[model samples]
Target chain A: MLNVTEMLEEIKNSPYREIEICAPHTGRVNFAAIQQGSKVEGPHGLWKEKPGTLLCTLDRERNPKPIAAVEKGELCLLHSELEGCFVEAGTRLAVIRHLLTRDEVQAAILKKALHLFTAPERAKYYFVPEIDKKVRTSGSQSVTVKDGMELFIMSRMKREVPLVYTGPAGLIYAVYFTHTSNVDAEQPLIGVCPPDQLAAIQEVIMRVQTEWTEQG
Target chain B: MGKSNKESNVAPAGGLIDVSSHKVLVANRGEIAMRIMRACVKLGVAFTAIFTKEDTASGHVRLAKELGGEKNLYRVSSYHDANELMAVADDAECTAVHPGYGFFAEDFRFARRVSKRDRKLIFIGPSWKIIRELGDKINTKRLARSLNVPTVPGSDRPIYDEMEAERIARTVFDFQVQQGIKRPLVLVKASAGGGGMGIEEVYDIDNFRSVYRRIRNYAMRQFKDEGVLIEQRITDFNHLEVQIVSDRSGKNPVHFGTRNCSIQSTGLQKRLEVAPGFSPDEINYSFDARKVLDDIVHYSLTMARKVGYDNVGTWEWIVTHDGSPFLMEVNTRIQVENGVSARIASVKGEGGVDLLAEQIRIGLGEPLGYNQQDIAFNGVGIEYRLIAEDPDNRFTPWAGLIERFGWQEKPWLTMHTHVPTDVPYEIPTEFDPNLALAIVWGENIEQAKDRGRLFLDSLELKGCKKTGGELKSNVAFLRQKTAGILQF
Candidate 1:
């Protein structure tokens, strides 16, 4: 069996990442201007427009409306049945990978604190460290964490339960919550980073947050 | 100072009501919210509306702003969150909350919360205690039995386990044998379910176990209640209901005639018409159509009074081919078909006493203002629900921007829709697909049918155009049903 420290280290070192393009509204896909494995710039490429440029059209009557790109990245995994297909709003249209160096990617992840656990609403949360903080950070510059491990607790009504971590294993970059206290749902309670997999982890976190905001 | 006679008649349970200064928060959406807003306008009361993020640009939000001003319109995340809705009501300083239909309209917890809130907001529908009593089918049937109201033959208690289900099925089979029913049918239903959901039909004894499990699973998923009830399924039956309005005093409950909604597809009501003797085929089924209707009205009022029901409600019943009416269930809120019934009632010279307005009046501890004898059942009205679905594509829901919505002007027809013209409207991906309803009233059923056909043909919703044509409405189905050429 792998020790808790080793498991956390393994999670922090692993790297796997992808970005998805989602449909802005519900309609029939008129056409797809770009194919998979196409390198594109922010807003413009095969579709030929700037950021917020209409990549394709969705027909809802005799009039066809535009579906625009929100960011600039290399296109990948274009849906096979894209043309003449009905797609609901918020459905993932394609995946994209941002072309960046290792140092630039790490800077991007740290700048936004994209690795933090943002509270969904205002509530009291209790932190429960899985491993001794001293042992996990003795030789490292950050705290390590693993997926499926409980690190915090939230009390709702009369029940007290642990708050689960759904993201991949990562290192705790910053600790914003020093005690069990009430915080706004929009506030980020902690900052985390996968030491060697910042790009992959950031991609997952961004996609999840995007979907969450859209649903709200 | 001397006390007035009207003041003496006020019920002690409700205390003295001051409707003149009351502010109501409408906790619903779509056409129902508009209906309630009209009532608030007529009564000279402040109205409030709560909407979600999806409905920020909806017509209901605009209507609420127009009626109650900007402060009265609130945008919440979810309609099902009772605490948030109550908080909005409190912030708005509403005197009462009117749950138009669906959502929390029949939720006993919401009613209790409103009544128990710090500010003590009044609920426009029935009291929470009464809602709890009638919401449970088992208790409703028991109360109906005690009041001598006819109910369908079924198990007296809820079936708990597999053994209990089998036992009830055996008993139903024996009852069918006694009634000389060769092709016996058993209906398994959730004790706390409504809206034609969580129901299953069992044809054979061997299939009882699987069907029961399936229905129980569905009930648990949908209503969070696994308790099931068994009832006999009437193969040939006519769907009918009586519209009744009562006050908190419970002494006077008046029925406003009967409505026939026998035409349905996949358990959803497609078309509804007021009065029974309109169609020759329908009249042929019953020995005396007038007497049957009278019986329905009488029984419905009787049960309403027994339950001490308040506000507007519909006592639904299923009339078998033998002309025996069995109490199916009770809808504690205003239904979609009420538009047609209200139109017919207005034509009867009732001075257009809107049902929603009457419900608010009753909530204010006022009487129904009129008695059963004063109601005049005149003219025929038919309503067709135009759903945003494809009939050719197995009725798949289609959502998109409505570019062109065209409907000709007609005095006889009244369209109840939230879709705005002049500007493009986007039908969201979530919620029910019911886009609008078209209600047409005439001197008689024949005239109403003719006008309905014409109105439907003129109406158009140019959403995402399919390969063959535009998105299909229920126009074809409504036309065929009106002509009596479509089979139910």
Candidate 2:
């Protein structure tokens, strides 16, 4: 069902997500039961044979606690010196990488529109789908809109609010919201074509991320 | 006045422990980092630089590597991340850390962490205790008043309610009337704010509540501290500051003369010149120009000595049109315009003491070699902050790839910037407005002003195609101000 080239392209574009495990307090590391590149599922997996597991015990003077895996991923100990040495609170102990094999795309309404669409129960809006009647459709199931095209119209109290789609033009594969159902901010209103067609959306997200990074 | 070897081991209340043998870590970026690196090179001390991801190709990083080898360059996610900075310092085996202004320079927690015994690192500035005390405007004003330093009359305490603000405004107005002052104005300032940020002027009593609320919100958003203080705004005033350096030996602090930064637009400093701009024959208050200079130097030293402040710090004051001076705030770190003082002090045959190097020596538990009388001010020095912003667009900050850049070097002109010209370089849009600084010194203010204009005309900034327009500078605005045409 998935193209091999498209799958590889998705893997290349997806950013590597890593979760770091830190020391709870200033203390010595009692033991590290897992090795580098070990698969860790969860905390309970440390005691049993499970797919994802990571565990390390730190010996504080009053309390000895176990630090376990928070997500299912391969464990990579960042500091080997922590085995018998003291570490201050907030020191990184290990990092886990969540490897992905397939591509998945998600579309959501911008959370910034909450002030206009929500909060008032009497608020009402509709998505006036920008379907080109002139263009010949490949089939009845295919519904595609260009980037910056009007995806929907949101109105509150008889006043129309402008809303446009900012992602790459592609086929509308799925719709998550009903015709008259209430939509929450940032809710996945619809599912567009994944992989290559989401490039515009990705660019917008990167720009926003850059802005936030600069602010920090 | 230098410290003996026997007293070097003991750390005073606000003094730096001996760290001469230690490697220094500069936890900053840009021109300030390069300035610190230069100081380290002069002292023959090995130094490391921590740069953000955005600064990997920056000139400061390259300079650090060239000075102390490639191993000395460390990269972090951001300059404000204390954890990463400490980790890098520890990895590099740095014994002392110099936080160039803006990031962790005033962060007391960072200072505490650096000075902790377990960390085994020394902060090359005042102690965390002193920074915390002087950082709060209310506490600083109180301390100044206690030390017989004249401070602006305002709400003696922090005002949380509108009633208190109104009452303080009325009291200040009545006092101004009694003092026979005209056009009394009130200012609401953030207690923990600096750099002329979070300051609002109140012209009328009717809009006091709204202005106060707006200032509080701005302060809360900018500094995360909503605490506000009210003070009488000096309308026709000259912004002057004295740079002072102290050591742990409890000896007298040295004053590096005074700088007049009156050429400011919208509260942002545009140009700063030494020698105060006014001659002794021009205006006479209670004291002549010489007496005023002497009084300022004396007050600055006395305050530093009282607080046991070590290393370089600045005391800012507002000299009213009527010639009365009032303490405004204390900057506990080296300033961007410190080159003006350095240049002025370096004039004549007197050995010019590098303020950054002096900071390092003080951090090494070395007493100031010279006292107040030994220091002399000669010639006039002026500095212009070259910011990458469009003046035509209300000073909106701009960022783009600088395709071409060049500046002519002159004997009287000194430019401090980290523009990467060898390779393609783009200034990050998210940082401060300042791209570089053009500093010039001459035998007199006129020569200095001439050299400043020449220096500005020699520089150029070209943007890439994607940038849409040429990179902008405030040179024209600065020239107008220097020529005495532009006035507030």
Candidate 3:
């Protein structure tokens, strides 16, 4: 892996990204109560069943569906001009400048540090039924995989065939693909950390934990 | 290619009432929404349509836009939200709401709200009272039994006492024995539980106690209600339906014809449907097929008349291997396969019978100008539900952006779909990925089957998953089942 210090330094220079929240459907938007630079929190709870902060309500066909902030951030930009006016779906409503959390920063660094097993083709990939069920119940990190293992079942064109793992395998450090959506060709399916690399990965995470300061 | 949505046509006047002033809100999506809009336009009535964010590019949205009316289109959060529909109706100044199957179609509460709300709009169906009366399974079963109409051979009410439950189970078994049935199975299901939960099938009466206790215990734990329903589990039967159409008067109910929907998926969901339920003229059967069809239709009409069913509805039934027809349930709204029956039915020798248009006319308080003697049937019609699914994988739904969908136009073929051909469409995962419905008509069963196969063969559907593989459809499965259409 590349030097973790340089990666951490680069991230330190810019530790935030502005994410735009758009109307999920066509509706008259009401952002009267929202103000710029206000703080927001994403869905949080043991199960994440508790919703995030309400940013605005998009009223259409008599139903007003509230758009919630999905990421913890400061409301840096709000489209106040479009308030009370009918807006089409995907219309820019607000933007949040979300600061990098400790987990996020570590995840960013680990993405480059981990040996990513990418999808060979654009198709729905699943960890062959047993592994899938295990991965669902327990986190993907609990499952260990080996090289040349029959891991995934790549479903395509109504046909299912076993997909053999080729790369040096280990504990799945991170699951990069969801079962519901399609994973693009060459997109990483899972980030694997071999037994030898586990210590190095831990050290990098520890170093970031100590040096990085989280912002409110 | 089919007629574009932008194509303007003059609406023809039908029935005795001039319902031109009414504006209908099509509170649904997909092909059903498209059909409702077409019906409204056909009757010269203004209609409004709604689409969710996922349905931005759907044909229904395009049709509503091109249909040309003030505030005719609106995007809602969900199709299930009744408030949104009512609000849209009020905003659009619509006088009626047509719940085009699914969503709020069969919901009596939604229908009641539509009628009872301050700014009331006609719930373009049977009145809420009638919907509530027929919507309840227990009420329907009891009513059918009271009328001497054949319902399932089982308890109309839930059995609470174990002795009573066992006694009913014994009667069911003895009844099957009296009917000379072999290997009769008794179904023990939690009255409070549905969707196949807490349900057990007992092949032998000796072991029913163990199964009953397990079900009762499971029900008490799961639903907190130990009540159970005992019914004779029917096997080797054909699922049939009678298309009933009546006016607001709730009287003079007449049937279009019988439709056989026995062909289904592994989950027992209907896949292929045929009008004129059976062909006694062509196929030989152990029982009188013609008499069975007539009996079911007559029973359906009798029930429809009893309830004052004031709109288009379907009476679902199952004909056993020995030809005993039992009423399953009553669908209080127009069905997805309504067109199949309409394809073969003619009112007063008029070949084209648009049932939705008739429904709207009747819903607006206009009586059905014709009676049972006027309605006639002439050909075999088949309806194929085209969907993006893997038949080999337990009908697993496939979600992907549909890139291309096309089919050749035939003289006897009518295809209904909300999927636009000119542009790619992302399949909305929130709802069932139903692509289209192809209704093919033929002079006879042999011809109908041939046409169905030809239609499926000529149909071209191409799509790819977001990640990169080709989309899977049930076309091959539908094609294979074409030969077995209406075969008992």
True contacts kept of each: 0.00, 0.00, 0.20
Show where candidate 3 strays beyond 4 Å.
Answer: A23-29, A33-74, A86-91, A110-198, B1-18, B69-71, B154-231, B466-471
Candidate 1 per-residue C-alpha lDDT over A150-209 given as tens digits, one digit per residue, 9 for 90 to 100: 766654321234677656577766555533345655677666776675665555445434
Question: What C-alpha lDDT do the candidate models reach, one value each?
Answer: 0.68, 0.67, 0.84
Tens digit of lDDT per residue, candidate 3, span B180-227?
888989989887664335677899999999989877866775567898
lDDT of 2 by residue, B318-354 (tens): 8775567888888888888888788778422464557
Please list the residue runs of candidate 2 whose C-alpha ends up more than 4 Å from where it truly belongs after superposition.
Answer: A1-104, A108-216, B1-20, B157-183, B275-287, B464-467, B485-488
> What TM-score fits each model?
0.67, 0.71, 0.79
In model 3, which residue pairs have backbone atoms overlapping below 3 Å? none
Candidate order by decreasing DockQ:
3, 2, 1
Q: If both were scored by TM-score, which would come out higher, candidate 1 or candidate 3?
A: 3
CA-only RMSD, every prediction: 16.9, 11.4, 6.5
Error of 1 at A155 (Å): 31
For candidate 3 chain B, which ten residues in a row score worst on lDDT? B1-10
Q: What is the lDDT ranking, best to worst? A: 3, 1, 2
TM-score of 3: 0.79
lDDT of 1: 0.68
Highest TM-score: which candidate?
Answer: 3
